[model samples]
Target: MTESDAATASLRPTDAIVLTGLRVRAHHGVFDFERENGQDFVVDVTAHLDLSPSAVSDDLSRTVHYGELAVEVADAVRRDPVDLIETVAERVAAVVLAHEPVHSVEVTVHKPDAPIEVPFDDVAVRILRGRS
Candidate 1:
């Protein structure tokens, strides 16, 4: 395996949590109509934490509560008026990393129905952040 692959493979089995397809209506875009009209945005997050404690203790307190995290992300996305998905992804990552259990997070913000002259499937931005 490559060095990075080997390093990732060495981590424990339950060390990460993934949340996907979190859709919300948010007012973020470069164009005025986009901000005014608002559009649906989808977020997918992978949070890295030491999940062994939760696994062994069988305690919810030992891990990040994904439902609450999803709501937090949705609420944040709905309120912000940012111009770029990159900014949205960064903001979401910061929130996830704020959790005590989370050591790092990867956030992807997908704008599937973005405005464009030509046809396309989707547009998105992804970012990775580690606790500091």
Candidate 2:
């Protein structure tokens, strides 16, 4: 494997907390009409961290609370609208990483109802972030 690949693999956490198909209505788009009307945006997030502490102690404090995380992510998306899903993805990642236990995060912002001329299933932006 390449040096970079090895480094990435080594840094990856073994356990994860995944939340998917979170739909939120937000005004985020370049077009004025889209911002005025608003649309549903789907977000998926995976937070990687060591789950062993919570597993062994059965203490909620030992791990990130996914329910709270979901709310934060939704709230982040609903905040001031930006034209790009990339920005939304970054916001979500920041929220996830804010939880001290999270070692890394994967965020996907899906714009299924994006204003597109041609028929398409969906448009999404996915990003990965970790502590440096």
Give the top-scoring candidate (lDDT).
Answer: 2
What shift in Å separates residue 43 of candidate 2 from its native position after superposition? 0.3
Which tens-of-lDDT digit does each residue in 11-110 have in candidate 2? 5868999999999999999999889999999999989999999999999999999999999999999999998899999988998999999889989999
The C-alpha lDDT values of all candidates are 0.86, 0.92
When summed lDDT is taken over every stretch of 10 residues in candidate 2, the lowest stretch is 5-14
lDDT value for candidate 2?
0.92
TM-score of each: 0.87, 0.92
Model 2: per-residue Cα lDDT at residue 54: 100
* Residues 1-132, model 1: lDDT tens digits: 897766565432347899999999988999999999999999999998898899999999999999999999888788759999888898898888889988778889999989888999888888777754
Error of 2 at 17 (Å): 0.2
- Candidate 1: give its CA RMSD in angstroms: 3.5
Residue pairs that clash (backbone atoms under 3 angstroms), model 2: none
User: After best superposition, candidate 1 residue 22: deviation in angstroms?
Assistant: 0.2
Candidate 2 TM-score, true structure as reference: 0.92
